[model samples]
Target: MTASGALDAPAASRPMPSLAAFTQRLRDRLIMQEDPATAAYDRIMRRLGISIGIAGIIVGGVELPEVAEQGRYAPAWWTVAAVVLAFGWYPIIAVVSAVSGPRAIRFVCGCAAMSFLGALASIPFGLKLHTVDATTVWPFRVTALAVTAAVLAWTSRVTVVYLLTAATSAALATVYTVSAVTPQHVTENFLRSAGLAALFVWCGTAATGAAARVDRESAIASRRAASQAAAHSRDRERARFAALIHDAVLSTLLEASRAGTKSDVLQRQAERTLEQLDECRGAQRDPDLLDARSAVLFLRAAVHEINPSIRFATRTWPGYDDLRMPVHSASTIAAALTEAVRNSLRHAAVPGREVRRTVTATVSAGSIRIVFTDDGAGFDLAAVSADRLGISMSILGRMRQLAGGSAFVESQRGEGTTVTLVWGGDGSR
Candidate 1:
């Protein structure tokens, strides 16, 4: 954590975090703070509901009618069963459609439930069981099938599920029609049934695919809205940090300079610390920068709405997040880096006695380091005040907060000043 070599290890050093881990962490944080048992129950209940919807579809659509009507002695209970499902299926399954994960599950289940119920209602010549007149029972079947298709299309937002349920529904309908005509036209019915199933599959496939595409677009729009909200929060935190620097630290530094008690080195260091603090979004903001001793490569694109200019020119950086430093250690290191960058920009002299000035950042071994060097005249190092707020409140103060780390300055006349920040390192990459 404190060395440069440890932080900038090559990619082969250790395995990177996986997609599973990222999603798992997200699940943990967004848990809605419910009791463990309550959450488990909710998840299970939703799954059960989905299962019931699917089961009702199969029983009503295919199994019940085939078993009851195929035998010469049809049961009166079968007609009663179909009618029961026709009226109740849609509203009962509607409760399960509210399940959240994947968002498509409930929709698919609901559509399937309605289609199955429709199949039940369509049992032809059902009056043969003496349950009702053939005319009355016939209308129930047609109306039920149409209602199920319409319900499936209207309720399930997922296109794939809609098409699948619809295709299955249509296949059931065509096959039933061919099978039920009073005088069995067995060969003609078989060919017509097969052809109808194939045609319905194609039509449903196209229509359902279109619906799925529309759902995908809706998801993208929602993500964009969430990102904008996070950016606003970061801006507010930055403003709060800036206020602390201006009101408390800057005022004291100015007073020290006026009293003629502060050394030249102290004044210069104070100016530098201010620069780093200015760039900071501070502790509460998701890390703008971190210690590199863990030698990690984080793709900035994954983080929502980070500064475009704030980036890694170097491929590898030290890691000190949940993977390494405990909460306290990471925070201490964050503060140190902020001050190091601040001091460098304020007071670094030009290197090689030239006038061009630039700040370069690099992480190596167990340290995430930034060097602010310039081609300006440098001053004596020993004459600087150790107690200067910039040095005491910023650099050394930050290092002292960390368990094992240090901040160092190296400078020479007519050369430049370089600030080095070091942190504790781990054996792993």
Candidate 2:
């Protein structure tokens, strides 16, 4: 499926009412969250292209002295212009590739093609130098070409195509440079350029492999998180249903046992049983329009399920439970709150002692705040790894997706950790 379709599919399949459905809703929210993959790719490509382009100008500078010193060799103009044009074109192409949606890879390959031509254009100069100063090598003129090839390799997935191009360029440059000066030493020049080209292409190949691995791992992680959330939601709903049934049916049975065969008591018990059954059936109806109190209850139940022992410290201002927000916003807050509590349970502990943590939900007129605080050992926020998706992706990212929402983390080593999520629906308030 396309990315958009994949994101919407989960939400469409499960309408929010049951805990499982809300969990799926949060999972869908996360899936719909903006991915950094595009921006990251663009930044790397732009940097590579601009850096290489600058290097090209410098390499061309080295050749200018040769062209000027050679008197009026008309062919020198072609080589010099080609060198300038090849380098000057890169930054433009890189910018275009970054902005161009599906054509980025193709644009990058075009750079490789241009780079090869730039190197080949230096052949006239190489020939001219051979006629003037036959003993000196002209390898420096081709340095721009090698650098361009490396940049292309870094961005392109088809490493074989780049390697083939690099190999062909090395062979051509070697043959031309050697034939222009000394045919007898062609073998030595070929080996040197070919070896360097091989090394460069090998590095490019390694880069391609590493990028592919990272992309694959990111996809796997996203899929796993979605699946786990769906399953967890289902389990929570099942437990809720079981509890409802036990409370309703078992209570009726106990009442009937105590007051057996009293006609009025039996009648009342039967009527109560029917009412409970009706309530149970209605319980599966949509929860998307829930008031603030119901959402808070759901949040409390979710955190309690994660760890039954941790005490909850909650407070609210007047009209706190009566206020309403969008279902998506509510689910996002709950998921983030759950994650914050889980983080505390996992990492909020000193080396030799267990400490209690508390999760608090405070609702005011326009917004709500969920704070998870623990006295257990905490570390520097800057010390956290970029790959830790629990805080970055689950908590901060989820909150940021909401229109008027933010996440805050305050922690210090040997002190404690506090995660605060503050949000006002769609930012209107």
RMSD of each: 23.2, 14.6
lDDT of 1: 0.42
Q: In candidate 1, what are the lDDT values of residues 1-429, reduced to their tens digit? A: 121212122322333257843543333222222122133333333444444455445545554554344433345665565546453453355343332321343454445446444544455545333333221233223332333333334433443354444444544443454324342333443344334534533453444445555545534533443344334434555566777688657875776767766577667666766766665534344532223432222212211122234333433444423233233444444444444443434343232332333334455444444433333333346644443345554556667666666677665433444556555544222
Instruction: List, in order, the clash count of every candidate structure.
Output: 34, 0
lDDT of 2 by residue, 8-46 (tens): 123223333678444433332222221334323433444
In model 1, where do residues sit more than 4 Å from their true spots?
A: 1-76, 94-429
Tell me the TM-score of each prediction against the true structure. 0.25, 0.52
What value does the lDDT take at residue 193 in candidate 2?
54
